[model samples]
Target: MRFIINILCCILAFSSCTEIKKYHSIHAGPKPIAVVIERNPGIRVTGSETPLSVLYENGTLIYSEQSEADIPFYMKKELEPEDFKILKNEICMTEKFKKLRNSYNLCPNILGSTTVEIYMSDGKNSKAVSVYGYGIELEKIHDRIPYPDKNDKLPDEFRRIFRKLTGLNFIEAEKWTPDYIEIMIWPYGNAPEKSANWPSGWPSLSHPLTRKRGDSYSLYMPGLEKNDLNDFLDNLKPKQAVLINGDKWSVDCRFVFPGEPLWMKAFNKMQ
Candidate 1:
């Protein structure tokens, strides 16, 4: 009789443990420490688009632009937990939403697609949504997920949420431009070393060389106008020939415009 009672008690304990596990799984909420929104500004004549990125983390908001010039300028502001409540609610980072998003197929042939990525506090879990065209599809999916109909315009709710989070109206391109322009120069392939004596006709601007790799260098030229940049490029002549370790080498100039902070950070780490 006592053996039967012990067996029944063990079964009851196992069932209770299973129920507790299920309850916690269903009630778990998203604990997001940081959120990043990134998108291209649009196609340019140069066949390159500048990227706009907004990062919210540690109660601070940072807006970064890498369009007009090489170095990106960051504008930062302090934020409170309340500032993110609306965005968090709108993101709806739950297991069900993630499953639906993963199953949904993003529309192809999209012109100027935007990628919105969210990162949780643990940094292991993340969710991403692709916005095609003007984000009509994104709105539709958000409005009627599990079965959404396509639309032409972005949802008003999404626009409001983004504007509040980034403090910029994305609808207007003119508003995205900052007052200052930044320029960066990267020299590769047996580039000439800096001269100890300044050139006679050299432009009086700060050109600090940041090493990129073995025998390569990057220079940062900040706060310059269009005319100033044009003049500098016109006067700067490519090295005709270079002698490295008794071998004749010719240098080529290639400009790299990093569209995202990730690339920029990687470049900064070189050397």
Candidate 2:
């Protein structure tokens, strides 16, 4: 009887210890990333009531994506790609909004086409469906080139902005490529505008809001959806006043020292 009692005591102690250590393992559960999509404002179209299905490499149910249709109130004339230009190929969701840092798991495979389909309707009379193209080989943010600055070093401006915007800090810019570092920034809150940390300039000639700086560097902002960016910024009130890479009206701090309070908590957690 005494032996059995002693064993029970040890089991109880172990259970108690595990309960106490649960908080330390918060990052263990379902550390997954999501692929979010939004209705295109330029199309003046709304989404269907039924949730859309997402397929992986060939035919695998990854996630059920559903979105309500949102069309512009103004009249949209039948415009060709060259008439009233627009960016039809843009991702609504990014990896920055998740707890897990490994987004490649949910993204396209090493070399394959990732399909994103949506059911959209104008709610009034026109109801149509469109399937967007998503391929892992393209839209890669990992390509890295020399910093525009003479030092040939990566810029830390984005790291500082990450701290200010999401209270998250990543590896040094020198260590990460523009593709490896996923960033989403907003110039103002509740405004329909936000930009990602893309290495290449927005596809110009198609996207008017984008500007090409030099042979190597390009600036892309206007082509991005404004409302989506604004909503993200509005949620993080603590990061108000923080700028991502700076604005045209202001000098870019890409070449400056640490400007914001780098969040060591996230860095330590990630490591």
Cα RMSD to the true fold for all candidates: 17.8, 23.2
Compared with the true structure, all predictions reach lDDT values of 0.39, 0.25
Q: Which whole-number lDDT from 0 to 100 does residue 33 have in model 2?
A: 17
Candidate 1 residue lDDT tens string, 1-271: 9999999999999977875553333223323243444434452211122333343334444455444756554454444478556545554344443543321223344445544332323245544433344332354455453333453334343345444444532222332222223332222345464312222332223232222334343223333343454454455456533332233333322222222333333222421
- Alpha-carbon TM-score of each model against the true structure: 0.36, 0.18
Return model 2's CA RMSD, one decimal. 23.2
| lDDT of model 1, residue 226 | 39
Can you tell me which runs of candidate 1 are displaced by over 4 Å?
Answer: 1-38, 41-53, 64-75, 81-97, 100-124, 135-271
lDDT of 1: 0.39
Clashing pairs in 1: none
Q: Which ten residues in a row have the lowest lDDT in candidate 2?
A: 252-261
Give the poorly placed runs of model 2, Cα more than 4 Å off: 1-51, 65-182, 186-235, 238-241, 245-271
